[model samples]
Target: MEQSTTIEIKDNSFARQFETIIPEGLLTVEYSFQERKIFLTKINTPDEFQDEIFLDNLIRTILDNAIEQRLKVVPTYPRIVQFFKKNPQYKELLPPGIRI
Candidate 1:
């Protein structure tokens, strides 16, 4: 059976910043201001080519690329270092199938 997963981002500000960088024609994303969360839904097509493995890989690639781009926008090394310090769990928090 195919399963869906939800990733919850605790930082509302980061969520807003993220939407700007996501590429078009990828997964469908919905944002909830009241809940302060972004919802991503995998678009499944009836075509036989659209299988579970394909959908999983597509989501992984898109999220990995988005995170990499966001890391580049960090203004300075000091800021990045400080961020990591405050959120030591960041290294562990990285999305599944992503390499830092």
Candidate 2:
């Protein structure tokens, strides 16, 4: 059987964002209660691990994290937005009235 990947998410209140770390990279995203939106501010991935499937799974993991926290997000990266746009099943991950 294949082992499931483990992605860790840590809330850094000092930075007002969640820090997600996967074997291939790290992503920093900020959540604003007043704005009710999560902002993906930064991403760093090793070139060797930049496969589309890996990236899609990474983004899905992030969105799942946000859902578990009961928050909507505004993905700033064009790639992320495009990915969500292409995948309608993940539409609920977007903030209301906000289209990618």
TM-score of each: 0.29, 0.66
Q: What is candidate 1's lDDT per residue for 1-100, written digit by digit as tens?
A: 3354443322235433222122232233232222322223223233434444444433444344446644322112243334334544444433344343
Query: What does candidate 2's lDDT look like per residue over 1-100, in tens digits?
Result: 2233665668787877667665666655554444666777555565655566656666777788778888777777777787789777778877778876
Deviation from native of the Cα of residue 37 in model 1, angstroms: 9.1
Those runs of model 2 whose alpha carbons end farther than 4 Å from true positions after fitting are 1-6, 10-34
Q: Which 10-residue window in model 2 sums to the lowest lDDT? A: 1-10
Q: How many backbone clashes does candidate 1 have?
A: 0
Residue-pair clashes per candidate: 0, 0
Which candidate leads in TM-score? 2
Candidate 1 residue spans exceeding 4 A from truth: 1-44, 47-50, 71-100
Q: List the residue pairs that clash in candidate 2.
A: none
